[model samples]
Target: MSNIVKKFKVENGKGFKLGDFDPAYSDGFKKIEARKTLKDLIDETFDLQTELYAANKYALLIIFQAMDAAGKDSAIEHTLSGLNPQGCQVYSFKQPSTEDYEHDFLWRHYRSLPERGRIGIHNRSHYENVLVTKVHPDLLLKEHLPGINDVKDIDGKFWDKRYESIRAFEKHLTDNGTVIIKFYLNVSKQEQKLRFLKRIDNPKKNWKFSAADIEERKKWADYMDAYEKAIKETATNDCPWYVIPADKKWFTRIAISSVILDTLKGLKLKYPVLEKEEKDKLDESKKQLEKE
Candidate 1:
């Protein structure tokens, strides 16, 4: 296990201040140096994932949460680039549809759980229900939970239940052979603004920029508070939240890849062993073919 990865993990996310984590902090690696390290990590990941798939006994679920333009998309693209597509799946959760609103908050995410022997990556996950909805409480009205009302008077207890629900949900996954590793891409507000500007300046990035993203930026402080509390409530041993610094794109990729490699290694995954009977059957078939 890498000691540096522990620096970024929130064992107890309680009192985690988004401001305390330096988004621009890097381990002094230039792009050239970082990519070399990253390549090695990716190779390790490919071999590990191959074993994970063949073992067919465990599943890995990776979730990413971040502020807009915090590089979630690119991070996913780069870190998991070496995986076999057949053994991996990526699901990007956007706003819910009319039908999605009809079910409980976790229903949609439950449907997306990775099958055994595969890796599932969620771009933005069910945590949004607690983070984004907590920031904009009024948005909760749209889903219309039984006790909620027009008064907009939800108390802390209301949030307590939601957090409890999230914890229990993850615990169930872990008990059932599913492993969860979550990442929160923590980008500084100043870095975010600069990136937003670059998006506006670059013609190719224009489509990524939107009026809604600007509006979301206006509520950055509230979002930070929401993320802090949500992470504090739900981070657990089976499902830890890694707060990755996002200002240095290259470093962020390497850190994420390293953490993922360490987790997979800890699982001690191996290809399944064939029974003696199975081995004898193979030998018999080979001998019969030779005789023919």
Candidate 2:
């Protein structure tokens, strides 16, 4: 499991390329084998989460970024199922609301951050400012920035600044006890097309199929380039990106669960121990309760 985490983790941005990863790779684990591994990982994560909540020293921020139909939702659902709801918060960032566009790109995301001792899951995150907007430069126009008056104005220097902003933002969060884990579900174009077809073919899934999805699909190459650039620019040792394979949903879930469990274990969280005074008080209270 540690090897799998290391294999997919991007700790440094230097010379990173998304295409180097195989979307269908499963690390020799069949579905049956992965199921058992996933269960054990989830159970351990649950126990660690309890200690984490009691310690109240660190907040886990898990971010997922992917193309359409890359199984981000399902992977999150299956992997984080064992978490205590009271200690977990999930935010799915969609098309920016009117209010969202009015502030700096990270404003809404900052508002949604989890407090210490909790886990926050972002379905799609502030990376969208770099990934989606980089792919469709026109979206920056909606941000209503002074210099970004036209798509043409969003040049190489503009993108470099956004990437720099992201790196600084993540650094500040990590310094403030936010443990960030980023995942990029690397789904191949062929698999994405098949998933899109299934949504269209199944009556129950028809609602999941959007015409806009196809429009995004048409720019798959552009998205890939943007993702590569974003990962290369912002990945750091403290905040690495895990490019998880998404062609096989089962494998994706297992890999993600392993990474999360590894992260929690690294934190070395422990349930708070009572001091001598508190222990004595508890003993005295127990004696009174017994008399009653």
Q: How many residue pairs clash (N, CA or C atoms closer than 3 angstroms) in each of the candidate models, in the order given?
A: 0, 0
**Model 1 regions more than 4 Å off:** 288-292
lDDT of each residue in 1-292, candidate 2, tens digit only:
9889999999998989898999999999999887788888999899999998999999999999999899998998999887789999999998999998999999999999999999999999999999888887888899999977888898899989999999999999999999999999999999999999999999999998899999999998899999999999999999999999999999999999999999999999988889999999999999999999
lDDT of each: 0.90, 0.94
lDDT of 1 by residue, 215-261 (tens): 99999989998988988898877788899999989999998998999
Residue 154 Cα positional deviation in candidate 1, in Å, after optimal superposition? 1.6
Give the total clashing residue pairs for model 2.
0
Candidates' TM-scores? 0.96, 0.98
**Among all candidates shown, the one with the greatest lDDT:** 2
Error of 2 at 222 (Å): 0.4
Most accurate candidate by TM-score: 2
